[model samples]
Every structure is written in structure tokens, then in C-alpha cells.
Target: MPVFSCADAIGGGTEPNGSEVVAVRVGQHDGYDRLVIEFNGPIPAYSVTGRSGTSFTTSPKGQTVTLGGTNGVLIVMHSIVNWTSYLGPYAFEPNFPVLREARQIENFEGYQQWALGIQGSPCLRVTTLTSPSRLVVDMAATR
Candidate 1:
């Protein structure tokens, strides 16, 4: 059995000067829903913070972005560049049991942001993976 914490999850110290977010993937698991951010280079410094509402404002632009759910999580990656390389969907409503939606908030000025809409307040577990360099976030299923 794996242990997950509701506390903020943070990792990586590398500066993604040449890296780009290649894709974003999500999956439904037995006890959690997983969100993955694929990168073309080394994974960048990132943080995951849980929030109370689904409404979030975009960085640098101040545009309001709302998602479908009672609670949400914010994902931020630093030192990232070249957002044009990511051709994947900017927003998706997976409608998973816990993870309801995933959307891109911003990709400007060496910073990247994403939001995950969740059904209820849930714990989060974040991990950095190699080989292809990816960041994984798991949200525990709400009862």
C-alpha cells in the first residue's frame, strides 16, 4: 500500500530553460485519479496546492477560469518555456469519480499553470518520473 498526504506536494529544482510540456495525460485508478504532465526535457520545479473553489485567475492576463467541481487543485511549474510545442487539448472534462476536469491556466513567461477540478476535498500525492521526464499527481477518491 502507498501513503498519500493532503499537504502540499512539491519537487524538482531543475530550470526548464529548454524543456517544454509535451502533453498532459489523466487516468482513473482504483483509489485515485492520476494526472500526468509529460515533458520533452527534464522535469521542472513544480508545486501542487489544494484550493476550496473551482474558480481560478490566470497569471499575467488576470482572466478568470472556472472548472466543474466543489474543490480544486492548482499546479504550477517554473522555468518552463516554449508552450507552442504542446499540441494536446488545453482543457478536458474527464468526469472521473474524483477528478472531474483538467485545464491549462497559463503558459507564459517561464511559468506554466494548470487546474484540476475535483468532486470533493481529497488528498494529493505528487511524484516525478524519469525516462521521458514527467510529473504525476494523484487525487484520492472522495467517499
Candidate 2:
């Protein structure tokens, strides 16, 4: 079993083609830490991959994202541009054993980017749901 919540979001989101990155949420479950991103409509293709370095830099733009953690999970949403700002007073990071940092990196050309600085890179799993479209991420709290 698991739980879900939309606890943090800053600067709101941008409207590109009438679509926006509606929310980024986090919650503590009995066995894992859960994260969810919501869209105003159906979700598009996305990827969640573990990073090998402490920071990630976007292509062509060279914006380096520094997230201090032993592990990193890069999240990219294809089909929507950022349409929002997520930095300074708007940054969202749980700073927990499972998730250390979360940010809205880029939202340009119909693509959105986010990252999760994680502790120890625990097992990561992903799922998608409709009815106000969401991408759910579950990271194991225990090895």
C-alpha cells in the first residue's frame, strides 16, 4: 500500500498550448517515499533515471543543477515546456533520507525537467494514472 500528496509547488506553472505542469507532490508511506507530478490533462512520455554525479546540466543551455546528495534521480517530462519557475523561494526539496532535492529545471519547447537528489539511491519505481493525469514515483525508504 502507499499514500500520495501534493505538498509543494512554487511560482505556479506556465501555460503552453493550454497545458501546464500542475503540481509536484511528496508523501511518506509505510515502506517508501512517494512523489507525484500532476498535469492539467493526460500525461505524456517521461523518464526517471538515476544520475551518476551530484549535479545535472541541461543540454544546449548549460544550466547546471546542483543537488547535494549521495544519489540523483533525473526526471524529464516530454510534451510540455516548463511553464513555471522553481528556484530561489520556489524550490521544492524534501531533504529526507529518500529525497534530498527536487526542482523545476527547464520548461521550454514543450518539455519540462525536474530532478530528485536522493539519499543512497534506493530502488526507484514509476507509474502513471489518469483522471487529471499524474506521474507517480516511489522510492524505497529501506533497502
Candidate 3:
């Protein structure tokens, strides 16, 4: 099992329109995954989107984030002891390096990790990792 905390990265106040944008840290634990979102105030509803690559839709409840593309990956981390046993089998070798590095960050402790990479002329790379109850998303812009 892993431990998760949302005290460090939660920034900005709740969106005045009953929404907020939070950069969550996700991780894995005990065969499950988790996510931790930080905010200055209560966040009723929010959605997260990538700058490029694949485009997806997420409901206002912030519970589901759907993704599409050739190499798109999505992980949901919402608890402090969730593991990543739900990620179905696929070719996950090439992405190990980026995932390992993001997992080493202190803010991403005990969170589940999910990643997605679109091959060929990609504008940016989005890597999401989670522990027991946190999520860490890394977006690398290409030039």
C-alpha cells in the first residue's frame, strides 16, 4: 500500500463558474491506482485536457477522462492505496523511462500512473503517473 497527499501542488482558487482546473498527482499501490487534486477552495466540477495529440472528453463530475489515439494512455488515481492492476496489457516497454522519472518526484508519491503518446509529428507528449492516491502529469512540448 502507498500513501498520498495533496498539500503541495494544489493551486489557484475554485473557478467562479463552479469549476476549477487542478493539476493532480497520481500513483499506484496494492494493485490499484489513485489521484490527488489540490485547490485553494472546493472544486465542484472540472475537466482536464491535453494541449495536443489525442482529444478526449471528460464529464463535469471529473470522474472519467476518455482518450483516443494510436498510443494514448489514461490512468485514474483516486485513493491512497489503489494499485494499477486495471491497466490492460499492451506494449509498455518504450515508455518505461519517462514513467520512472515522473514516479520519482516527491509530489507524486503513492499514486497511479497513466500515459499516452501519439506517434508521428506530435506537438507534445503527455505522461501521467499515479501512486496510492496521487497523480503526476508531465507534458513535454515539442519543437
User: What do the candidate models score in CA lDDT, each in turn?
Assistant: 0.87, 0.66, 0.30
lDDT tens digits, residues 1-143, model 2?
A: 33322222222223334446677788777767778887776566666776666588864487887886777777776656455532232256777667777776666677777777777753676777778777888877766
- Estimate, for each residue in 72-143, the C-alpha lDDT of model 1 and write its tens digit: 999999988776667778888999988999999888778889999999885888888888999999998954
Which regions of candidate 2 are displaced past 4 Å? 1-18, 81-90
Model 3 TM-score, 2 decimals? 0.24
Top TM-score model: 1
Q: Which stretches of candidate 3 lie over 4 Å from their true place?
A: 1-23, 47-143
TM-score of each: 0.92, 0.75, 0.24
Q: Which 10 consecutive positions of candidate 2 have the poorest summed lDDT?
A: 4-13
- At residue 104, give the lDDT of candidate 1: 90
Query: Which candidate has the top score in lDDT?
Result: 1
lDDT of 3 by residue, 1-143 (tens): 22322112232223342222234444443322323443323332222232344333332333433233333334333232222232323223333322221111111222323344433222222222233211233322222
lDDT of 1: 0.87
Backbone clash tally (model 2): 5
